[model samples]
Target: MEVTGRRWLLLHADEPGNCPEPSTTPDDYMGGFCAFNFTSGPAAGKFCWDQQPDYSAFRESSFGHGILEVKNETHALWIWHRNQDLYSTAGDMIYIVRQPERCLVESEVP
Candidate 1:
């Protein structure tokens, strides 16, 4: 689904043993999840969650601010800064690379 102009993926663990069943009470639960690339898109060959990065910093109820700085048409810098962190510090950061030629349709290109 799309929220605030950003797209989100709903990941689920395919193997029962890889994840635990949902709990009735509110608690932190860790599980394996995966996001596959679209069959045909700029992100056609990219995948995530198979070797997932640590996301404990952004856990439930965590408050943080994020910044996405587009370096170019194909590269962007994403940073997440927690409320408790210093202004110059980044809790997490990543470079987002886009494959417009492979992912964007002709009509969508500027």
Candidate 2:
């Protein structure tokens, strides 16, 4: 969530400036997660990741924003606000069904 130069490296290492891909295996432009070289700073062209399918499926279908609300002790809500509907128009509201359970706190957790 925190945007920084390192994040940018991971997001965009396959651009025209970085490593040139082989023509035999035409690279999928919009897929794959990447790893950053933490030890190196803005040295350029230093990242790695496994091959991934073209990410058209996730991109085309994503079209809504939602708010996460903790209603009460036993329930929460996720309401997706669609683009077509007005702000007042409740698009898709659902009770985010949950069951509370005990959690073990780490030594660092006060």
Candidate 3:
């Protein structure tokens, strides 16, 4: 269940207040938004939840859902639609940017 080179992680819960501790398993993971900046190494600029506080919109519990469309290697669209909204409407949308040149090590480069 290991995931590598992933810039975004989504956690969805089926029952309200039933979110278990974070795990590799999708059904057991739940948390607010977390961003890790490797620009300064693993220990520096690590585990930041406040960088985009509003990104918490993705952490909605119970019937929360989203879709991710990768436009290319560097850009992708993330759309979160609430249960109350029409399927064509987006409750929240954001662009995910990947900086492989800046984030990946020489050996990890593709």
Give the best candidate by lDDT: 1
Preferred candidate (lDDT higher): 2 or 3:
3
Residue-wise lDDT of candidate 1 within 4-83, one digit each (tens)?
55666544554333443333322434222223334444334344123333543356465888999999977999998888
Q: Which residue pairs in candidate 3 collide?
A: none
Per-residue CA lDDT of model 2 for 1-110, tens digit only, reads 34586564243544445443433334366332222332233433434323333542354353668888998866788887766776556566788543333222224445
TM-score of each: 0.42, 0.33, 0.44
TM-score attained by model 1: 0.42
Query: Which candidate ranks first by TM-score, i.e. highest?
Result: 3
CA shift of 28, model 2, Å:
33
The residue-by-residue lDDT of candidate 3 on 59-101, one tens digit each, is 5563658999999967899988778766567877899886765
- Each candidate's number of clashing pairs is 2, 0, 0
RMSD for all candidates, in order, please: 13.8, 15.1, 12.4
lDDT of model 2 at residue 16? 44
Return the lDDT, model 3, position 42.
26
